[model samples]
Target chain A: MSIIIDQLNYTYSPGTAYEKQALKDISLVIEDGEFIGLIGHTGSGKSTLIQHLNGLVKATGGSVYYNGADIYDADYNLKELRTKVGLVFQYPEHQLFETTVLKDVQFGPKNLSLTPLEVDLRAYGALKQVGIPDDLIDASPFELSGGQKRRVAIAGVLAMEPEVLILDEPTAGLDPKGRDEILDQIAKIHDERHITVILVSHSMEDVAKYVGRIIVMDHGRAVFDGAPKKVFSHYKELEGIGLAAPQVTYAVNALRERGILVKTDATTVQEAKAAVLAVWKG
Target chain B: MIRDITIGQYYPADSVLHRLDPRVKLTGTLVYIVSLFLVKNLWGYLIAALALAAVIRASKVPFGYIVKGLKAVVILLLFTVCFNLFLTSGTPVFEWKFIRITKEGLYLAFSMAVRLTLLILGSSLMTFTTTPNELTDGMESLLSPLKKLHVPVHEVAMMMSIALRFIPILLEETDKIMKAQQARGADFESGGIIKRAKAMIPILIPLFISAFRRAGDLAMAMEARCYRGGAGRTKMKPLHYHGRDAGAWITMAMFVAVIVVSRRF
Candidate 1:
């Protein structure tokens, strides 16, 4: 039900002159039904870490446990593990290959050896979860708007009925409205399904708003792991690693500098608004 | 699992072979391959092998890395050896129904195997030491005479370099697409040949779309950069021949001389 990564290390092209160590001794526990944000700058091993979770990339050292069972052990079924822990990669829309959106969404469940009826059912349910209109479901995914195409792609993973859903930069390359919609839909899925959700992103604001806990990775190590408020309070140290809290947190800190009483840890627009209102009323 | 492809891949290093003029390396490879074929006896082959070993040592590229390039042509080498073993006419050492192993056949097979290995290794050496840009520059320079015959030599060289550059990029894209499909419970393994081929459709379609999209983007970029046809082009850093290049030519001349003398004897 939970994933425990112990001392994971990965090096690409080991022993070659082009060898590069991508991940270094990264150990963490993702408890059941937890909404976690894994944030890091580019080349910070974020993609490599998520790939390890689903067994896409094997760890050179250490082990990953799913529900207290070592996933890398000889007996574990890798396909079953991949289904249980779904990964929606960055620019996931490019993965869509079926002619129609519904067919593309059904690809996952179909591959699970489900009955055709069951596969379609799961696909329909996933499409509904992602809120794709029925008419658009019959249209070619390539012909849809960029945002719609992305939703279908997400639905493709959602149809797998994974217990632990990991999204790597799910809101990347989306317009502001599209980004908000995706974030809200992801939050809705987490709440309704009660599944463990790990969002990998570099946009500090997006993760700050939704994820209860944030794990900040820098140079292949999780440097900070705590609640969003507690982590954002260390904004100075976060910025040292090329990361920042949400703009509102900076704004709140600016207001505090003028001797106004406000919580400097506010990350979302609503939290900043409420904090400002509270100070004004006081 | 598909990352083992090393064809046309360059290994950057600071060594005499790596720093040699691309034209010299290219011409040297050609001469070396021709000389490898000219070897008539064991002594000639030994000389050629020594020359190859010297080049490998001077390049500072790992001996194992250069040897690994031989893996790509293993099947071809085996086929040539097999063909030479059973087909060449000579005094028979072992004879069976429709199968004859002769002394000359054995010698021919051995020599052909060695020649093929050297051929692949020699070409791989040139590519491993030379960057794609330099290779294209050398190729365009070598083919510059073809321009007199109305051939678009520059464009042809550009195409070759672009194709060479995109090999790794396309492989990376294929890897990503395969992983994406696998995440969705697609099993690429554990299938019969036909079933496995069917499974590849999901990967192929997306890869092709992305590749075409990339091609379009690259075309646009080239056009935006005002990349006209190679007519009236001026080089940014024109090819220069140093004293080492002269030494390289002398060495090539000596290699050819040895092969000529071996053939004469």
Candidate 2:
């Protein structure tokens, strides 16, 4: 399902001295089956904006529409909306409370009032989708390593069979290998299931590698929203907003500035290498 | 969903109450509470109420915030008023079966409610004006004399300060944990009392584990900082009672005397 946020505004602790405007008139359209990366500094309202997609936070002004239906309409079921747009919060593994990985993964499907057999089937399918071993499903989630626990938590959301999955800093705190493994798993899931994926991250490298579209948020506003390559090309603006383009993009831009004519749009290391080689051959 | 709880919330202000020595404020609260109970008649209660209102206004804390603070003790206030109204034997003004509503009982209930309300407002005023660190510092200084009697005054104050400091951090952690669990379909909102409590297991387990982890990290951090308890520790900001603090105390004493004299009549 496509998501559209129309002139949304959010203020925290309203009518109090601590009142803060977390999101300011943000409007954006997220297409179906697209991999979108949301990048922002701390307290820039990226989290607040995404939370609005699943109805976790009601917009103080304006509305969110899921395929032309108002998400905040009285007839709309928030719980069902959440199931449709699964949100894997930052450091999601800290939420693991079930006895076994299987039970934890089954929790989401069970909430939908699915039959016991269907719950089991979906839980097993989700575990497989996330590449978790069948044998490990019976093991306690708390006993698993940090990466394993993170996978289990993601699997728990996947079991609900959400059409659009929103992950906030999924690769955070993971080692390089673990991060790559998780990102690859996410990419595979997106391709296989044709699900819309919203990845919120601070790492430009991760977004450059995986996301098709990049949305840069600064101070509760969407400063940039376009194709990843196009967004990275605005290097000066990105840097001005306390964000960096991928390292390879920065390197390619530097090379071009130094009279070495190369494609400065290359965001990945391999792409940068190829562009530099092409420049040398010319 | 649990983030909206605003009990004991500190409002950052630069009012006189906020800048006063914490020890002085703490002692002043104690003395003011004692004086509230010493008042008997309607006029005495009115004087005490006016004194409390003056203090609250001088503190520059919003009146709405004081009302919010009173919300937590609404049931207690009601109980006290009801008990004083019904249980205190006096000349009856109205009778209904065994229940007697007396003129004296009505007056007693009104005075009791005012006293309790003022007492709560006075204490809450202290918390609203003082940050947790300042309160703990004042508490340590106030309790310092008990150290000679072998009481672990510093240790207790240290514990209190740490607890207060961690309260907000823990609350934020709990909120994140709850949301994470909710994302995992741990239904915290629905179900009967037993079922809801059962649902909290997932939240509580992680929260407890994380709490223990934080405690371990804190201990290690303290050790790394060469923390050796309060044996030879000196505060960067020592407490000193000024002439203005003395003047304030004297004014409070005079206010208490006026209430005492008025009540005796």
Candidate 3:
């Protein structure tokens, strides 16, 4: 099922002195099997926007429709919506509380009111999909390394079999190898499961390498939403909001500035390399 | 959802009360609370209420803000009022079956409720006018005499300050953890008391773990700066009483005199 947000607005602490407009008049549609990157600096309301998808935060004004039904309606089942649109928070591992990794992964499906056998089966499948070996499944999640714990957390969400998975800053504070492993796992999940993936990150390079579309947020507004190259082309505007394009976009732009003929639309290292090679071959 | 707490929250203002020394405010609050309890009749309570109103206005903190702190003690206030209203024995003003309404009970309940409300307002006013740092300094200075008995006055003050500082941070952490658990379908609402308590297991375990983790990090941070039990440390800005503090003390004394005189009639 697809998700549509129309003219959404959210204000924190409404009617109080500390009131702040976090999301303003945002409208967007996410189709099935789309890998979308939501990019913004901290406090830009990207997280707030996504929270409305699962009915976590109600919009002060406007509506969010999931599968053409308003999830905020009284008749709608919020628990089912949350299960279908999984949100893995910034530090998912902090939510891991069960004694064993298997139990932690089973926590989501168990909440779905599924039978014991199906819950464990889904947990096993999610663990295997996240590449957690069977030997470590029965051990305490706290005993795992940071990356392993993160995967277990992700597996916990995956066990619910969500059609759309939203991960906020999934690779934050990880080493280079851990970052790649997470990015690869997310890509694999999207490729194999055909679930719409929404990745929220401030890192341009990571998103540029994976996501098909990018939505740039600045000061509670959707400033840009397009392909990675199209979004990177507005590097100056992005930099104004304390965000930057991928390093390859800068390299390509610098080459063009020096009167060297090359494509300035490159958003990845490989794309920049190919552009430079094409110029040299000509 | 835990963000509505107003206790220990400071409101920044540039009024006379805000400018007064923290020591004076703390002592003044103590005097005010004592005077509230000293009140025996309507006249005494009126005096205390007037004094409280004047101070709240001078402090420039909205009365509504101070009243908001009462939300935390609402259940306690209700219990006290109800117990005094029903259980205090005296001449029956009205009678119905097992329930007896006495004139004395009515007066006692009204006085107790007013006193409790004033007490909360006076104390909350002090916290509202004083920042946590200033409060800590005032507390340390006020309790320094206890050091003669080998008490760890400075350590106690530091611990109080740290505890105050962590309230907001931990509240924010709790909110985030709650949201995370909710996303995992851990239903914190819509369950019986026992079932709801069971639901909290998922949240409480992680909360405790993170709390310990944060405490460890804070300890390391303190040690990195060579912090050692608050010994041999001097204040960057030492607390000193000014003319305003003396004026405040006199005002508090006058208010106490009012309470004493009003108790007579």
* Model 1, CA-based lDDT: 0.91
What TM-score is obtained by chain A of candidate 1? 0.97
Give lDDT tens digits, candidate 3, residues A205-249. Answer: 889999999999988999999999999999999999999999989
Clash counts per candidate, in order, are 1, 0, 0
TM-score of chain A of each: 0.97, 0.98, 0.98
Model 2, span A85-125: residue lDDT tens: 89999888888878899998998899889999999999999
* After superposition, candidate 2 runs with Cα above 4 Å error: B74-116
The digit string of per-residue lDDT tens for model 3 on B57-162 reads: 9988877767778888999999999999999999999999999989999999999999999898888898888888998899999998999999999889888878
Give the native contact fraction of candidate 3: 0.67
Candidate 3: pairs in clash:
none
Global lDDT of model 2: 0.87
- Could you tell me which residue pairs clash in candidate 1? A1-A67
lDDT of 1 at A196: 96
**What is every candidate's C-alpha DockQ against the true complex, given to 2 decimals?**
0.77, 0.57, 0.62
lDDT of 1 by residue, A1-282 (tens): 689999999998777778888899999999999999999999899899999999999999989998999989888899999999999999999999999999999999999999999999999999999989899989999999989989899999999999999999999999999999999999999999999999999989888889989999998888999999999999999999999889888999999999999977788889899999999999
